[model samples]
Target: MKLAELAKELEISTESFIKFIQDFDLELSECIATNFDVKKDFEKFAKENKSFLKKYDADLGQNKSVEDIAKNIQQPKDKVAEILEKDKIKVYDNGFYKSSISSYGIHQKLGGNYQFVYDYFGKKTNLSERDFIGYRDLFFFISKTLDPFLHLAPLTDWGIHKPAGIILYGPPGSGKIFWANKIAEIVDYQFKQIKKYYFGTSFVDGRRANFNDFLVEMMKEDKVLLFMEEFDVIMSERSEEKSVSSCDEETKEIVLHYVSQFEKEDLLMIGSANSLVDIDDEILAPGRFDVTIPIFPPNAHERAEMILHYLKENLSKDAILMKILETNNAHHLPFWKEISSKMKVFSNTMIIDFTQSLKKKIRDIYLKNSSLKITINEKLLESAFREAAAKLTGEYLNQVAQFLQDVSINNYDDFPKRIEALKVELDSYKMVEKPIKTIGFTHNGDQES
Candidate 1:
């Protein structure tokens, strides 16, 4: 069943259902496929909450003012307004709340119990079976940033136009491109990468090609998201100390020329950068690529979930690797948590490397002693961990530190927890000074023979 069909059967508007999802931070991709196939969990949730849906729709249908909401919910008008303000809800000139507000939302403001909803939909904060492992805070933050694109009320009533350009800043292997594609999916836009060759005058099939022409064609499409990597280099600040390459300068100029029209043309441009320090001030202007999201390496808890996810994704239940994991209880997240805690400041790429190395080591061990049962002991796990940790060098730590500084300046309040967690991890790599001892000369001054 499609979400629209489910909404119709339940006698509710699709927008109401979508609002409920947004309020709860549920990704439509998890509950509904591209072909509009609704997941069984979501369908069952809708069917079981028929009365709730009807009441939710009815409450949203009422165009209530602050006083009306206060009266209905038996809260003070000042309190109601404060809650709305805290949530970033905007009202009209007549003082009525936006259509996006609902009784469910008000109840949530009053601290009503909604664990049942999360329990039914599967908690987004925990380890989910979805493609991504964990980063509930980042996902929620990104969702809010994309809200203007999801609903017109933010744009129409609040003057919050969709972001023309966004920069995903983080260290390498932190999945900047992954979030770019995720934004494309959420907005129902076509995902297209702007390649290096596209920046230069290149030939395709003996035909002349240029970025300006390609961009014009892209704007002609219904809705499109253009992703460009190495954004820091391409949009580097102009300076006499370090000159920008001609190719990069040209590309930056072309983008600046067309950027103001992105929202009008139903287009969005996302830039992926390892660090934001080098991005030009013009590029970071209010109406330009002002919004910056910081992607961090997974923390210990998330690293464990990622390891378990990779293991399940690659190994079959009956495979030898699975057997060994089960024998040592390594198939579960708790077992991986012990080892993941040791991998301080490990990137998502390092987690993957650890899994691959572990698999190879296990395979080699099994081949050497076919008749013997292989135990997943510390020695085996440490060998793989050491190999993966090789990538966690001083250079990588410095990159992480730089990323932390950039995020602090750009988006500190939006993600303090992530920033703090990453800072702690990076601090773990700091070199502590030890007291040095002077050469011994005591009563045995004869060279301490």
Candidate 2:
């Protein structure tokens, strides 16, 4: 959005606005930046003067009547008159006193000065085509929350509050952080991240001030999305742990403050974590994260698509690639599409790394080499994928199984008994170590069949 486009929407003369910005002490370059914040200066200016809004708007447009001003400002007509009287701003006539007399006023006498300065910036999202690998239903459900009637008070009659926040909880590398920012972009809200460890002594004492500033600014917008990554660092379930650290106490205080404001603020707060099972239930109760979404490592079909996302640029329609992916044939895809799918429970990050290494391997061996034998070393790619995939799947699966166990076992008296009972079921999902895990590769880059 350029200054000229902004001026058209603001209905202000570009020249006058350029000069008026000097009042806020902003350089011309700063305002021209992509999606800059002008409210900070506007609020400062408004506080400095009692009758600034009316005077500010009037300067840009015709002096608006009481009814016109009330409608434009979204205030009652009577309140407009009260402000006029309180500020001593007047319209002169044969006798002056017009609030009780007429429905409309003379524009010239009113002094044309109306300007629509109150802009609650909220960008509507148009993100149907952007794929986050999978989670198709999750994105669709989130997008539906942006309906015009989503904020309507009438819907609350059903016992569901208008969605104020959504929590995305899943194992690490499930791409919770990616989806959070994607949601922000789709909904056209300014995305801001909250750090994981602010409660430590190394952190500033005025941490609450920083939070207040962000929350206050967020409330100013019609829709704003705040992303808190790795939230469990401070918001871990208090009941689960007996001892409360100073950091946890500070986090509790900060969360409580926002909980109070959540009801009134028009915000779409998104919090992401490896798992929210540990996060305090109170912070997410009901309207807080009215929608608690669970994201898992991509399924087999999703994993294949994810691999194609990175490889499609180089190898979608290649049959050898599909063979290495352990598929008979790809119905629709590029050459790099068929890397190895034998690797299970690999995070999207791991797939990305795996695919990148394959591309690099191809570049180094086949694409860069001048030899007549331009065959891909299937065994090398398989080895890389196996090593990467086998890194954390076993450990993470154990954590997930343990978390499920924790959710079920409520009584401390029978905690160990319940865990032991779950141990078998948990082990079934765990990856058992095998002796022949590595692929046999020859100098020619082919597997020894």
For this target, which candidate reaches the highest TM-score against the unseen true structure? 1
Could you give candidate 2's per-residue lDDT for residues 98-202 as a string of tens digits?
Answer: 232221122212433323322312321112212344444344344445432233444655554555777776667778888778677665677777654334434
- lDDT, candidates in the order shown: 0.80, 0.51
lDDT of 2 at 293: 56
For residue 10, model 2's alpha carbon misses the true position, in angstroms, by: 38
Off by over 4 Å in 2: 1-130, 144-159, 196-209, 239-244, 313-340, 371-373, 402-449
| lDDT digits (tens) for residues 1-449 of candidate 1 | 76667877888987677667656656655665533467887888888888888888888878889888888777778877887776656578898986668757776767878777767766443233565766765765786688788778898899999999999999889989989998898789999999888988988789999998889989999999999999999999988899999889988999999999999999999999989888899999999999988988898988998887777675555878878878878777789888998887788999999989998898898899883378888998888888888787666777888999998888876666677777776765555333553332111001122
Error of 2 at 241 (Å): 4.7
Q: What's every prediction's RMSD, in angstroms? A: 9.2, 21.5
Each prediction's TM-score against the native? 0.74, 0.53
Q: What is the Cα-based lDDT of residue 327 in candidate 1?
A: 84
- Number of backbone-clashing residue pairs for each candidate, in the order shown: 0, 22
